[model samples]
Target: MKRVVALAALAAALANSARADSATSQDLSKGYAKFSEQGGQALYANVCQACHMADGKGAAGAGRYPSLVADPKLEVSGYAVALVVNGQGAMPPVGRMMDDAQVAAVVNYVRTHFGNRFTDAVTKDDVKAARP
Candidate 1:
């Protein structure tokens, strides 16, 4: 009788542990769903990293990707947003590939990081407005 009780208690404990594990797994899944990079680093990795390089310094040559750092054109956030959304000259409208939030992130990222130090952040609303 004592052995039976011990086995039952062990079984119940295992069941409770399984339930706890399942709950923790569900919470982790929810956390992943909510995750996003507001800093734009992730979006840049997926989109701009190839052409712009990780440094944001850009490249020059046959198809010159202009430097995002210390560029006079980026003085206005609107100009950068417009260029990203609409494309200009040699660059394609790569900004169209991203939604408003992603666009805002990358624009804000470029404006603030690298050698550029423009303080104003590009909002998702600004990205939406730039869309054509």
Candidate 2:
């Protein structure tokens, strides 16, 4: 009986561990942690840099990721917001995994970085409006 009880406890522990791992995997699969608390720069490095590159110049060869550096497309905040939220060809709608605040943060970060000097900020409200 003790052996059976020990086996049951071990099984329960394994099940709990599996549940935790599954949750972590789901969060990563969604482009990043759901509404992750990380700041814009961190988010960019963790998520966007894989495709867009660390310098934001983007990459090619395997795929054609556009350069964000001094791109005129970022002049308008709304356009960037929409693209991030809805995505364009090749780029997935990564913003779907982010909340409005997270979306705005990463957008604002990109707009301000990579040779971009756009002063205007993308508010969370703008992100919300851009969704769907």
- Which has the greatest TM-score? 2
Off by over 4 Å in 1: 1-39
Clashing pairs in 2: none
Best by the lDDT measure: 2
Q: Write the per-residue lDDT of candidate 2 for residues 1-132, one digit (tens) a residue.
A: 999999999988997786578676754432234545456887798778989999998878976888999999999999998988898897888888788988899989999999998989989999988889
Q: Could you tell me every candidate's TM-score relative to the true structure?
A: 0.66, 0.73
lDDT (C-alpha, whole model) for all candidates: 0.76, 0.84
What is the number of backbone collisions in each predicted candidate, taken in the order shown? Answer: 0, 0
lDDT of 1 by residue, 1-132 (tens): 999999999988996776578676653212222223334888777567778888778898877786777777787999989988899886778776667888888888887777778988988999898899
Give the C-alpha miss distance for residue 124 in model 2, angstroms.
Answer: 0.7
lDDT of 1 at 80: 87
